[model samples]
Target: MKYSYYALFTTNNQGRIEVTFPDLAPHVATFGNNLPDAQRMAADALVGYLLTAESLGIKLPQPSSFQDLTPDSQQRLIPIEVDTKSN
Candidate 1:
């Protein structure tokens, strides 16, 4: 199955990109060296999170619309795709 989620991407002082998913509470954030790396890291983070949620019988929350999110100067909303089938 394919899952869609809104991710918040931010650039830290260290120049690493930080990714967070607001809809998933107690969620883990990941960092990458750059944009493309950050995006890939986000995908891995989501997959690992979801797999753990599944193993624990935790139902994943429905994703919020990308348009509904408000990002500050340090953050931006990004649409991400997760394919559980491949996991």
Candidate 2:
């Protein structure tokens, strides 16, 4: 399934590209020194995250259009706040 994700990208202190999909809590990663490279790396990061979640039986939040969800649940998928780093 293709879920719509909100991505944020910016240069890091070390000059690498930082990327985040706010919809996925604690699911951020980074790579490369530019946007294109960072994008490929981010894609890899998502695949790895999902694979690991499936392997460990972690429950991924179901994808939903925030408008179709309750206000509380909607917050989880919105990019209200973001830190300038990756984990």
Q: How displaced is residue 32 in candidate 1, in Å? A: 0.6
lDDT of 1: 0.86
Q: Score candidate 2 by lDDT.
A: 0.57
Which has the greatest TM-score? 1
- Give the best candidate by lDDT: 1
TM-score, candidate 2, is: 0.59
Q: Tell me the whole-model lDDT of each prediction, alpha carbons only.
A: 0.86, 0.57
Clashing pairs in 1: none
Model 2: runs farther than 4 Å from truth?
A: 1-4, 64-87
* Location of the lowest summed lDDT over 10 successive residues in candidate 2: 74-83
TM-score of 1: 0.91
Candidate 2: residue 20 lDDT (0-100): 68
